[model samples]
Target: MADLVTEIRERALALGFDAFGIAPAEARPDLGDKLAAALAAGWHGDMDWMAETAERRASPKALWPEARSIIMLGINYGPDSDPMAMLARKSTGNISVYARNRDYHDIIKGRLKEVAGLLSRRTGAEVKVFVDTAPVMEKPLAQAAGLGWQGKHTVLVSRQFGSWLFLGAIFTLAELPVSEPMAESCGSCRRCLDICPTNAFPAPFQLDARRCLAYLNIEHKGPIPAEFRKAMGNRIYGCDDCLAVCPWNKFASETREAKLFAREDLREPPLSELLALDDAGFRALFAGSPIKRIGHGRFLRNALIAAGNSGDAALLPAVEARLGDGDPLVRGAAVWALAQLADGERVRRGAEAHAGGERDADVKAEWAAVLPEVV
Candidate 1:
């Protein structure tokens, strides 16, 4: 059994996986408590799926009672440059490093499937595979399989790979020997906590997703809660401020997968160009990328927030044009952006023109809300 496992690890490395391990598939009693606490606090924000799939994610045995061993795999997507650098260029959008290229779900799923097939053929073990899409508790399972520790940021932190790994898991009926779990090695560092633009971390190893920029920009729909908009800065997609600051990243290596590297067009894309995108243009730009999932309305909503913060005055035309956008979400965001860049008289004129036809309560409130702050 040990020899076969060794052979599997070698094959995984050959197939582009940087880390691999196995552990017993049993009920994780502690996960239930942590998940319950997070949900009770409403830290998951609009990601209600976390609550809907709680039971299955809480227990591996509940998910697959037939499985005796769980295999965790890691593939590095470490950035070639500091992702934070883009923040300095405020006229451009700062997207998370992970979304700068092809969607990882598409890339890692194929690799995981290939490795799972090899192991099944070798040992005749019945197997199932999963990527990020499932209800599986991958971070905890990966830690149990000896890949790495769950850091204070609530992401897996490896001594060799840092916080830059994308995890996948395989479940098999074979009772493979388990590896020793990796111990938490985050001494007393609070860099990940201190550097947050929104202070999303409530405590070490705990996150308030409601206050997280990534959550507001990605999973969140409709106009962003006004309080978080200023703090959001120029981030148009997911934020990577916390991940890029980790000390463990010193030991990390650049990804060997060309598909995972940053695409030149996506890396700090011009906010002006992004504002010009209609639904068809948005789809064309992000066709093969993960950013497409949020769709154009949400994408424009985020871009409008960045436009508000830009203070460029040049973006006023774009913001004004979006006031009549078919999507209410886009119009609300545009009202806020116009208020930020347009003079008081221009803002009032915009309210007169755009506010009359607007039926959405949220859009009407944005126009009214600006008067107290700017008028």
Candidate 2:
């Protein structure tokens, strides 16, 4: 069993996993209380699902008692380019490094299954692979398996891979030797907290997801709060402020996975181009990428916010066309974009044109407010 574990780790490394480990399928007994405390403090925000599945998340054995071992893997997806460089180009929407190309879930899942298959062949173990999709607490398990410790940012940070690695897990029936847990190395750093534009972190190792740009742009289903729009800047897809500001990233190497590298077109997409995308256009452009999952309406909604923060009147016409869009969320965001441009007369005229036609109450209220000067 020890030789098999060694062979599995070698194969996983050869298959491009930057870090790998195995752990017994037992719950971290104290994690449940910690998670309960986090929930009580409202650190999870509107990610109600996290709180809802607290029990299963706190324990791997509770999730699947039959699984005697967990094989944790981390794949580096670091970009050769600076993720922060796009901020200088205000008109171009700044997507986070992870989402700039192929979705990591698809890329890593395929590789995980391949490795799991090898383990099955060698040990005749029944296996199930997961990458960011299951209720299983991957970070805690990875930490226990010696991959890395959960940083103050709440993401696993490795000495070797930094925080640029994507996590995945394979649950198996075979009882494998458990790797020792990694010790927390972020002694007193607060770089991630200070770097947050919206101050999403309430404290170290805790996040208020509602205030997070990544949650607002991706997980959020309705109109983005007016408060977060400007702070969002040109980040149309997700925010990387916390991750980018980490000092440990200096040790990170660029990813060799061509598919995970940033796509030329997605690197710094013009807000105008993104705002111009209709549903079919969005699908065509974001094919095989996670951005496509948000659909055109939500995506354009985010693009409009970026355009608003862009302060470039050049995108006004594109924003104007959406004033009467079928989606109320898009219409509301368009009105906000126009307000940021502060071309009141143009916005008033656009509002008048859609007066009787507009039916959504939220959008109508936004149009009504546009007529009143901000005193």
Candidate 3:
């Protein structure tokens, strides 16, 4: 069993996984209660799937009855440059480091299957694989497997890889030797909590997804709640404040996988280019990226919010063009953007022409709320 575990670890490393560890399927007995408490507090925001998968998500055994041991793997995707610095370039969009390249789920899952296949062939054990798509509580499981510990901001922080690791898992019927769990090492540190633009972290190690830019800009379906627009700044796709601010990242290095490196266009795409994207253009641009999951309307909605915050008069025309967008969500964001960038006459004219024809209550509300101020 020890020899087999050693062979599997070497195989995983050869295949490009940066971190590997094993844990018993029942290693995290505390997850269910923790999940219940967070769900009860409504911290998950519009991601109702967290509640839907709670039972299966909280338990590896529940997810697969035959699973006796679990293997956790991680790929380091540390950025070559400071992600926070992108926020200053308000005319550009700040995509999170993880999404700057190809979708990690697609990259990690196939490699995980290869490692799982090796284990199954050696031991004749049934196996299952999961990435972020499944309800697999991967961070806690990764901590349990000694790859890292959950940091103050609730993201897994590796001593070697820092907060830049992308985690995946392989579950097996074979009872492989479990690795010792990592101890929390973030004593007297609150950089991640302090750096959050929207105060998403209510306390150390706890997050309210409702206020999280990552959740708001990505998972959220409706218009961004008004209060967070300015704070959202130029972060069009996802927020990296918490992860990038971690001190542990000082020890981290950039990703070894060429496919995981930030694409030249995605690193700091001009907000002007992103704002001009139609559905087909958005599809072609983000074809292999996780950003495409949000679709063009929401992507434009986020860009419009960034434009409103940009204070750049140059984006006024792009913002105004979105006023006639087919999607009310996009049109409403454009209204808010116009209020921020355009003068009173331009905004008033927009309201006079479009507010009357606008059928969406939310768009009407946007006009009503801003028209009083502009006038």
Candidate 4:
């Protein structure tokens, strides 16, 4: 079994995993307390699943008692260009580096299955593979396995790969010797905290999902909060300010995975062009990518916020066309965008023109407030 574990590590390295480690399937004793503290404080806003499955998330034994060892793997996907460079162009939407290419879940899951299959063949043991999709507490398990320590951003960060690596794991029935855990290296560093545009991180290691741009643009189902909408800037998808400011990223290298590299179309797509996308157009543009899962209505909802923040009159027409969108989420976002473009009289006229048959109370109220002389 020990020799098989050694061979697995070697195979993982040969297959391009930047780091590898192993830990027993038993839960970490401290996880329960940590989760209790996080949930008790109301830090996980709107992420009800995290609170509901607290016990399962805290312990691997509770999740799957039969699993004896966890094989953790890391795949680096750093980009060649500075992720922050696109923020200066306020008219162009900034998609996070991880989402700029193929979804890591697909890419990493395929590799995890291959590795898990090889382990099963060698040891005659049952195995299950997981990326971020499962109930497994991958970050805690990876830390236990010594792949890296959980940094202040609450994501695993390595000295070698920095925080640019995506994590995956394989749980097997065979027993493997565990590795020593890595020590937390982010001593006195608050660059990730100081750089957040919306102050999403209230403390060093905690993240409030409500104010998080990633959550707002992706997980959020209704109108984005007005307070954070302007701070969202042209970030139509995920925000990378916290990730990009990490000092450790300077040591990271460009990804060798051609599929994970930044696509020119996503890097700095014009807001005007993005707002023009209908459902079918969005599906075709983001095919095979994680961004596709958000659907056009939710995606355009974020794009409308970006168009509003752009302060560019050129996008007014694109925003105006969506005033009557069937989704209240889309219509509300269009109201916000139009308010940013039109002044008192124009806004009044625009609102009156669209007000005749509008049914959504939110959109009608927005129209009433922006009437010509009211501005």
Best of the candidates, lDDT = 3
| Candidate 2 residue 12 C-alpha distance from true site, Å | 1.1
- Give the winner by lDDT: 1 or 4: 1
Give all candidates' CA lDDT scores.
0.89, 0.85, 0.92, 0.83
TM-score of 2: 0.95
Determine which window of 10 residues in candidate 1 has minimal summed lDDT: 251-260
Q: How accurate is candidate 3 locally (lDDT)?
A: 0.92
**How do all models score by TM-score?**
0.96, 0.95, 0.98, 0.94
RMSD of each: 1.8, 2.0, 1.4, 2.0
For model 4, which pairs clash? 348-372
* TM-score, predicted candidate 4 vs. hidden true structure: 0.94
Error of 4 at 306 (Å): 0.4
Which parts of model 2 have CA positions greater than 4 angstroms off? 254-259, 373-375
Per-residue lDDT of 102-175 in model 1, one digit per residue for the tens?
A: 89888788988888898899889899999989889999999999999999999899998899999999999888
Error (Å) of candidate 3 at residue 304 is 0.5
Tens-digit per-residue lDDT, 271-352, candidate 3: 8999999899999999999999999999999999999999999999899889999999999999999999989898899888
Which residue pairs in candidate 3 have backbone atoms (N, alpha carbon, C) closer than 3 angstroms, thus clashing?
none
TM-score: the better of candidates 1 and 3: 3
